[model samples]
Target chain A: MNPISHSPLSIPQQAYSTELQHHLFGRQLLAAEIPFSLDVLETHIEQGYVAKTFGIELDHCIRCGNQDKQLFYTFPCAICRQLCTYCRSCIMMGRVSECTPLYTWTGPAYDFHVPKSVMNWSGTLSEGQQTASDRVKQVILHQEELLVWAVCGAGKTEVLFAGIEAGLLAGKRICIATPRTDVVLELAPRLKKAFPFIEVAALYGGSDDRHKLAPLTVATIHQLFRFKEAFDAMIIDEVDAFPYSMDPSLHYAVQKAKKQTAATIYLTATPSRQMKKQYRSGKLQAVTIPARYHRQPIPVPEMKWCGNWAKQFQQKKIPRPVQAWVNERLQSKTPILLFFPSIAVMETARPLFQNLPAVYAEHPSRKERVQALRDGELQGLLTTTILERGVTIERLEVAVIGAEHEVFTESALVQIAGRVGRSFAYPTGSITFFHYGKSKAMVEAIRHITSMNEEARKRGLLDG
Target chain B: MGFSMANCYICYEKMRKPITWTSLFLRQPKSRICSNCEAKFAWISGETCAICSRELDESFRREQLCLDCLRWENNPEWAGYLTKNVSLFHYNDFLKELIAKYKYRGDYALAEVLAPFMKECLQQLEYDLITVIPLSKDRLQERGFNQAQALLDILQINSTELLTRIHTEKQSKKSRQERINLPQIFRVTSRTAIQGKSVVIVDDIYTTGSTVRHAAKALKLAGAEKIETMTIAR
Candidate 1:
């Protein structure tokens, strides 16, 4: 077992992949990876640039604008302190210290297999899906930045199948990148089934498919750092999702992964205000599908005023209204999801709901509980905002314990609301904001959902 | 009811625990691995082999040497050459991966994982000086750091390069019998430091007892009074 083989072992066929080839020749190659491309790489020990060469007191990460936070996780490194102060922000991927060398492949790039047809997803697209799918094809040909501002459960994955097939038919490499691992897991199988002939690999931390090579790839954005100018068309799912929305390095990775002339697509249910402004300014071409494939009205969240729920939690008690709501959901056998503002709040609430034996509370540590919930073992799951996206239950009902908290931003509230009325079997369910007082974010989230439904009605897209 | 934010190194799960007090305070100076990873180690406690310090199964005689050490006793020239050997942990898959991560992947932080255990194990033995088995010049440059030296450098005791291995095929590539039969690769250097001193030789692993035996042979020939072996695992 050669442990240093962590580099994606690109076979000669895979090495010739536009994506893998770009990565092979990309900017950030580790010292160990250089030997694999020894004949191709232009060799030079990359001493992290000479700051004083131009007489600048230079100390800022060119990659992510990371200046400080070094004192937190990586104060004194084990390796040469002068040579290895290690960046803390991106340490989870791999340590990037001053002494780390970057290799550049100067060899000729290889060619990957160009199939005659890549579109095999035979399922008929809804009218909305068809329009969005057509826009994707146009965007790829024009190499424009496109944003697919579709509502949640709008067959967003189906819309991509057409464009992916289009790209594959054109013999252009493509990547479907998302911020969350759950999306990668959710999409990999559906994508593989849609285009069964093409190899599909899903890359994530400790993923079983980490080393596999596929012409069509689905990976979390973090994995994009492994590529450089690789994709001819790049589709970014949930472009405004957390961690990715906050981490500037992930944004940098997305830009670094695609070709300079590559077409870019950003898909989201709730786009940031900046994205809306970008669309208005004609900087990004916009496509919106406000209704799901079922064309049912979205379940707008109703504010349930529970006076002093926080005070109740401190007293080691769930509020009467909250407990009553849980009892109601349990009795009706509605597999519900309760979103607490914090993990601490969720834990304090877990014991209070034990009357419902099948009811479980999950925070970060309780990832295993998610599996049980998916297995239909749990009737209800109490979670933090971690499950707001990337989770789907056929008839799942959702409630926010404290929707007014700062953590429940406008974008997050929209995503949490989007969780409900997702599957076709239900298509409509109660979404409640059990709050002490309604914040501006809560009000804005209601407005956002209402407006999307209004637009769906005006377009005559509703099934009713 | 609550979960920890700090992740376990082995399972990479956030649920196992928060960082322990020992990890917070002493792991840096001692062994810095997470408590969960430290727990995975099967510590060699209780009565151990008089020569190799490997834990004796109930089937083996307590007073007599273990099977590996007993074989050394068969060869008069190798017998009594080393006073004793002390190993801290059993060489399990976890330790194997840990050592591989350090030696192969160049993850230097893992070297600190067993520093404290090694310190405790060594305190029980008596040696005038400490030295580690050295790799050939080419292997040394290739790996950038000696795997054994990375472990010994953590100890407060005196560690010096008193011996060297002449260029030879890697010990891992050789079969058990071939490894036992290979000509001695070690040559003692700076005998002035080793001469008239009881020495403890350190290595990452004590496999087949061939490496420790060969190093001990070279040290005894260099006029060392007594030779002992110390390794992180056996």
Candidate 2:
């Protein structure tokens, strides 16, 4: 029944078999989702062209590597006619149950052809960016893990162009995974422009490139759950971002998505406490870029006591100091971003700011409002911590209206401060922390910025 | 089934079942979904068609039947096959997404999330036997479980496999005319079990009412006396 020698298979069957092979290569797919009939898949299995394993094996989901017993539940399966266990952790991708099998191509691997010249980026990297870029290339070539401890707005993405190009020249598959869909949407276009000759598949929740095979893939880390041992090199952008830093399943997914010896480059502005400890202990190799590409220091946040903002908000009044800060930015026509502790507080205080646009995680027009702020259509915007990272607005003044709130972690506050002074023409801006009371996170955030500035000055990475 | 910290099946948020004087003494049924996600479901209420339970506007409430049900009843070939259908929720966007995740995505736990609603509607119906609308062999294997049967299983209700279906393309892909005009797809299984008995057909959703009607016709021809249908959504 083997069709390798063109046995008696019909034309359509042959075409489907070839198409299945191409799609299943470097990807793990649910058996039910495979378009071809089981008979054809069985033939491929007999010919050693495909391998199938239980979707959930040994009480863990093979695709997403979820092992939590609480996340696994059983249902009476119609096909098996018995109780079958399934993983709820990755059920959003598609249910991976014990009775189901995950299909992966086991035949010859596809060779990705790369063009002679892959790097098409015209802009030059600064001194700090160039040094970090060379280190990334070295790490990829040696198949080692490297943590790029770059500050925000330090041209981290530019540093990866050289490493990605080198990996492509070596005919290796590379994947750039980030925690947020916003980062994937932002990076996909930039990567496509940088490597004009190669195909780049950007995968997210509802992305249309789910089945496309390309040499380079940029996707949300959740999308990496669908792949297994697929890439030769992996770059995790925003490594310390939410859901990725807190969720172990995502960490397991990243580990499962790459080859055993694959190089991993972790790019993060504020490393997690655990990551920081590991780097200091020499457990993980590292490179640090402390200065922005404009050869300027990060904007330090100034603490200003705006007394009892919550009580004032209950009375439908903006705190005196907070009101003064908004007036200054509005009068000077300086575009500003005011971060609130929560969406409820932001909405309550929104009408107080002349009904300026408020952007949060679930705001419907968040992208348009941010774009409007960038286009100078809006003088200022009120936001939550969702804009803490992955957003850069030049000459933008930022303030945390309730900096003492528990949501304002040290890393979050630093990232918020990093949103200012991003462009070369405007390398200095003011950041104010208008808090009712001081918290340990607020103090540490200030110290974090000051130390980074001092480190940059000591290394002469900043201009005199 | 037991009280513990459970994540919402839809949003994955940690659902805290509030404790109260009543909850302390009585065993409350744990919710599988959070309140926020639960609030999004539009419960079918107010005036609805007598036959298919499709929601009707105020102007159409006097008609007592929706236009689709009227068309079904006007045809002698299909009239009176399905005695009545009681649906629990409206087919809003949220319910559409919930059903898609449950049926197409193989999220079997959603059956538990939907069990209470289904049970509340089924309790008021009088029937000798409860049966799920059968799925074709290909579809059953692909989805791993029959959605209607899962609802019954979650409620600990015993349902007889009174009907078998022939393998065919998905009903959603067919147009309304194509669905109404298709050849008989269900065959009665074990005629003795359904003969001279009133049967209630359980299904995930009652869209166009063709699927339940076909099942009812097959059971009716095999000697069932009365045929009624219960669905989660209209």
Candidate 3:
């Protein structure tokens, strides 16, 4: 196991502890960061005293439960043992050895200074959004699980304001978690602005707010591992997104992060078909907003067969249609986002597009470049699907060079297409699928987007 | 989670393994620094100064000793300075950043970066006693560790504090004369015990010969027979 070796932080204890103990009690904290030494805390525990019943549940890691972990790793850990058995999974976050004690406080919870007015936003929700928001608020009050199946660009963040306000008024500590840092970065400022009175901390890797306690936490789902029964409202946005959908440890973290009676609201533009089946079978309470916030229909993707694209790249040349499309976009002075299946392939073809000024290519490792696209400083960006979700570029034309590749799943294709036409100012834009041969996923993605637009039109949610 | 391969601690790049029969029978040398980042490290190899072991600039065509070491070698007052000083790496920006990350940034895991070198130095050297440069309690409290002790700890090597540092103004903030003149910062804690025994002094970095020279003088006056100094980088 690669060890969970966090760089030791040297923050002054007084700076964050007072707020931390107030907001973080009845919750879990990173083992290394608690105010008192573990031995001191352990001594207090051994003398027939548990600090908080919610605290000091010492069997496995609180974050990413070490359920199937094996005792293979041996290390000289002063806190645990000279030889310690660490969990292999979630080791990226930190090394969670069996001896590392994760404590929580079972409360007669501390008193929260809930503000009289939590939300300062005065924006109006559309009728469909209003119904879903009301339902979300009701479900939170009832402490039930619900899924918000809203379309991409449906103002999903705005729709949650009412529900979050209701939670705050009821003196419930809430956490908004997502699978990726991109979403956390995008949502945190918006949330803090909406609920100005509530102290909201954005938690992510290297974030200053990691120890500074606040009643409201906006964090990546990976960060929630250190939280146990921490919140009354645990809203996982982009719940069907990668890692969250693919990794079970994240699910385990979410369960540990929220109270047993806490409401869990899953918000996603593309919930799985299995989830839909579960919703149909009454396993989950569900609501859907078919229309986008812009009141304009999504543009359906058009398929253009660019024959032997793989061969063309092998010959070190961009296919005619792909070059022509880029030329046309550049001629029109429209910024575009071209999605490639892999970084290796995209980088291979990067020199071909270098003729266009301000054109760049990026992958998951190069997230800083995404800002250049967002600032409209670039003519276009050649990207892998890391930008498939949680990115909004106005008037951006999107094209997928290899839409039929196995990497381009139906859900992924939908998200890639959803990147176009996100803003109200640019309510509609083109999404083109350039493929070697059409795969079932490509067809499904096209059908899914068309059906969604059709449904929005039928519901009179589209602008006349 | 569940990394089947080790990752480079400094840059956090995963160390990928390529299959070959050499790895089948004999494992490759384990290194915390991957080959790519490893190339960035300017090691103190090839020709070096005889006294302080700093890398020799070939253009100068100096003898075995560098100018500073030659300055000491030529000086009757500082001649020999007890024995020799050995260093592992050149104090380049790459090493400077690494030490900053390890010592100042409080990344203890980065101690692994010096583990193999520390081990090789420890194994090759013959010493009756192994001691490391110590941090004053105040500095220790601030750093949460002794930078020198961390390198020894990574390899599970035994090291004791032969001398303790006083709370003087930081050596780096001073000039060469000010540093050498600052004070007798080190005191011989157990002079009689080290009598006639060879000792090796370990430190994290060796910028000038001043700190180690002072330590060697203290040890020599305390009746130690021989004193050698080694650091992860110069």
Candidate 4:
């Protein structure tokens, strides 16, 4: 059995009473060198822990040992009696309210299932996707480690189903971890429908399935902190997503969550140079996916320069070429997605599009705002890289305003382009990047897409 | 030549499995208190301003606010009402020692023991969202982590990194007056996201309460209905 680690220490036990130590341990048998005597522990058990730690006085509670004006008396909760001033005013008192519990989300409850018609859906697999699925299938069957290197829109998620189904059939516990909630929410329902019988969980921030640790979990990588060698087979989706890719701690998290006997599979649209090198050197088993699901070549976005767009925007004059392009696209009623380099530029450019009638929005907003982008309620969506992954809309043309800004790195630009031409209905669309100056990243992004298209074409992936 | 020596060291450590500190220390009977840092002082929970952690006498009342928190004087637009505030420690060396391990060290083991202590400190109150004062993007990038985020994560509380610091500067270098009078240094990127939401600001230490107060002011400006603050150390 793997040893489970605990959360960080908040209070020094030596400074605390015997009762506090018992409370920290909880009822569950925790494996640790707890610094306490048996007699002291027994004495604490006789009287409750919270009362000893926080003494109540004359209708007011001694909150962190501060007794000021009288606060409302709330009965002791299972956890503690000392509520913060904010919790004191809560309608439910100090109880854990309906705010989703922080844990993994397994498939819907036992009785819940999506309709059967949606389960057997299939689409054309790109050469990159076919190669990835084959590699993942081999990994799960043989219990071997493998890495799948695909460019964006190479249909990595569909390739995962075969491997996940293999794990489920074999009765082995599996977890697919990513670094973002958007990906987890998107993948959870898809995975659930694909393997309806097997229990699948989606674990991310604000998910309420803590106690429901299923055999399989689709989780954001941050939630990996809670597990210790708990997974038999682990697949990390979007292995190159931000923060996760940048931070070594998250990499440690991936390694830590996998059981010794488990096979780890990494699926990424854009593999880091280090990973690519490792694959070439035979240090990692590798597969490549280089085309969209529709087998159409990824549309290489054309780059245009808008000299001093920010300065021009402040003076309330939209660039003629850019304005003409927007007018043409909007006249066609083609929903557009305009990417900006930074929030500052996005805010500056937002007013320019207001009366123009192109629908615009930002990330981390209400579901309705994001929904507007997909429902085509807005003529266009103004966005940062926050909408780069796990979002797909049909028949949308994308333009990057100020694409040459330092924020749009080679990888980021590649991802932004990947957002174009995702769905089968809109296999190809016009993607133009308006910049003040041409950048190496911009060229690299175009080159990256063209190269992938070249690979897919060489494999005879494209149909006339 | 180095391979054999390294192999021998690895073999030696591997042979000594199940290392036991209890067995080693059993021979020597020792006191419970930390030997290095003597208990020089006890918990001195004296009368303090409920809002700002300022020690005060009987003159302070719920209606009569602290000088920093006086709504009309400090922030005229916002009412600036917090239910209550309190602290167990004075942000001294002892609290700093504990915080270093809790934050930088990835010592989440300490949080399991300490979170309840924070919970105990959160006296009776109603909070809608548990929020932490966000670290500047540059600071977060340099630190490779947010200490406050880690603490709240361990507490298993619902928190949002909503209020982003637009500018990166050494906050500690400025006086309380400079901090209050400081220009609109922070911005609420997610206004409607937090509108009508109740929030409790969590931080490692609260000194003058200016930082949390400013954060609360920003949240309020974004149309947050109510605000409160709690810290590990006062």
The TM-scores of chain A alone, one per candidate, are: 0.85, 0.94, 0.87, 0.72
Q: Count the backbone clashes (under 3 Å) in each candidate.
A: 0, 0, 10, 38
lDDT string, candidate 2, B112-196, tens digits: 8898877767888999999998888878887888899988988999899998987477899999999999999998888888889
**What is residue A448's positional error in candidate 1, in angstroms?**
2.6
Of candidates 4 and 3, the better by lDDT:
3
After best superposition, candidate 4 residue A84: deviation in angstroms? Answer: 24
Docking class of 3: incorrect
Listed in order, the DockQ scores are 0.08, 0.67, 0.12, 0.02
The per-candidate TM-score of the B chain, in the order shown, comes to 0.85, 0.94, 0.89, 0.69
Candidate 2: list runs displaced more than 4 Å.
Answer: A1-21, A33-35, B1-4, B19-25, B59-62, B190-192
Instruction: Estimate, for each residue in A1-464, the C-alpha lDDT of model 2 and write its tens digit.
Output: 45566552433432335687678888888865678877778778777778999888887889888888878889888778889999988887788888788888887787667789887888898888888999999998889999998988898999999999999999889999999998999999999999999999999989999888899999999998888899999999999999899899999989988999999999998998898899999999899998998898988999999988988887899999888888998999999999999988988898888947899988899999999999999998999999998777767999898899999998999999999999999999999999988999999989988898898899889998
Best-fitting candidate, measured by TM-score? 2
Shift of residue A84 alpha carbon in model 2, Å:
1.0
Give the Cα error of residue A415 in candidate 2, in Å.
1.2
Interface RMSD of each: 6.1, 1.2, 6.6, 18.3
Candidate 4 C-alpha lDDT tens digits along A1-464: 23464322433342336333322321111111124544444443443331122223443322211232321223212122222221121111121111112111121112223333323446556566767787787787677888887777766788877776666566567789998887898888988877666567787767876435476688988776555456778898878888788665567567767777788898887777788789989999987777666778888899887788888877887776688888998899888877777776677777888633222333345466557767877777677777766667788788888888887887788888887788877788888888888999899888878887888788787776
Between candidates 1 and 4, name the one with more favorable TM-score: 1
**lDDT tens per residue, model 3, A125-206:** 9766887999899988878899998888888888888888888898888899998887888889999899899789998988
Q: lDDT score of model 3? A: 0.76
* TM-scores of all predicted structures: 0.73, 0.93, 0.78, 0.53
